[model samples]
Target: MIPLYLLHITTVEHSESLLWTFLTCNVFVVTAGIVFMYKLFTQKKVRGAGIVFGIAIAINYILIAIFGDPFDLLG
Candidate 1:
């Protein structure tokens, strides 16, 4: 994610196409993560790391939803 953010910061000024690509990929990845987590939850497979990951994703999603990008807060 940091690499993608860095790429965005570096290339966003040079290419609108890359910017759109980045947005599309980001959306796809986040959607995929959500679906995967839902499947894990439904299947009762959320073990130790899964529990940590799910909680982290949920917190980040909530923070981003309410605050309009809270990655800086995470840092």
Candidate 2:
């Protein structure tokens, strides 16, 4: 999904891509993590929740900078 946004950014004729990057990454992380957290909550492995959350956030920001807007989007 993040890659898809990047590809979209490339073909979209110079517009802001950061918004999309942040939106897609965070939304996916939060949504997937919520389900994962709920499932693992039953197992009492609460620590796994923090680790997963951190990983998700880390990856998103990495991708965000890699695929962020090129300043031309402001036009």
| Per-residue lDDT of candidate 2, residues 1-75 (tens digit) | 565554334433324566665566677788768967786867766676667777887787566446654442332
lDDT of model 2 at position 7 = 35
Best by TM-score: 2
- Each candidate: what lDDT? 0.52, 0.61
Tell me the tens digit of each residue's lDDT in model 1 across 1-75: 555565233321434554456555456546657766786778855565465556656665553445333443343
CA lDDT for candidate 2: 0.61
**Which residues of candidate 2, in runs, are more than 4 Å off?**
1-15, 44-54, 63-75
lDDT of 2 at 51: 78
Q: Give the TM-score of candidate 2.
A: 0.44
- Listed in order, each prediction's TM-score against the native is 0.43, 0.44
**Which pairs of residues collide in model 1?**
none
lDDT of 2 at 69: 44
